[model samples]
Target: MATAPTPVRHRPTITRTAGDVGAVYQFACPCGATGEEQAARRMALVDLNEHVLSLPKVPAAQQCRTPRTHGNQLWEPCGLCADQTSLFDLEVS
Candidate 1:
């Protein structure tokens, strides 16, 4: 008797939004600083102008909430967000 082949499952893809890309910034420690200093020395993941320019074309997978604030704009809180409040039990002003 011949057995039927199983079907493959497809995963849904996430879409990135302009707000998501601008939410948080990433940084690298040059002096290998730890603790509070590390956070202070963090750099922007993407340039201000560049980030704004690419916002419209961002991918879905890269979309998410961030603590970064631009002018009067506000973003949702998430683990990766720059805002301390969004970072688990960390407090924010």
Candidate 2:
């Protein structure tokens, strides 16, 4: 039987760590996408945003790909909207 190909995990990731000169910013994702080092935190975030927006939009399967990670949340049939913010907003009060 034909099976679905392995799902390509495309998540915008920003990994930053300290270095000799200063802090190093890395814009990388599971889709094998990367960028040059960014010295500014804001710039790195911008890079991440651009990369994320450029990627193909994931269907509303109750998944969160932002910041590149398959969050531990499942799609619920609750009457709430299926937008990204409504699904992954941890600070929901």
lDDT scores in order? 0.28, 0.60
lDDT for predicted candidate 1 compared with the true structure: 0.28
Instruction: Give the winner by lDDT.
Output: 2
Per residue, candidate 2 scores C-alpha lDDT tens digits across 42-81 of 7888887787677654455434444224342222111223
What is the lDDT, from 0 to 100, of the residue 42 in candidate 1? 29
lDDT of 1 by residue, 26-69 (tens): 33222231121111112332333233343243222222344144
The residue pairs found clashing in candidate 1 are 14-60, 15-60, 16-59, 16-60
- Residue 54 deviation, candidate 1, in Å? 4.4
Q: What is the lDDT of residue 81 in candidate 1?
A: 34
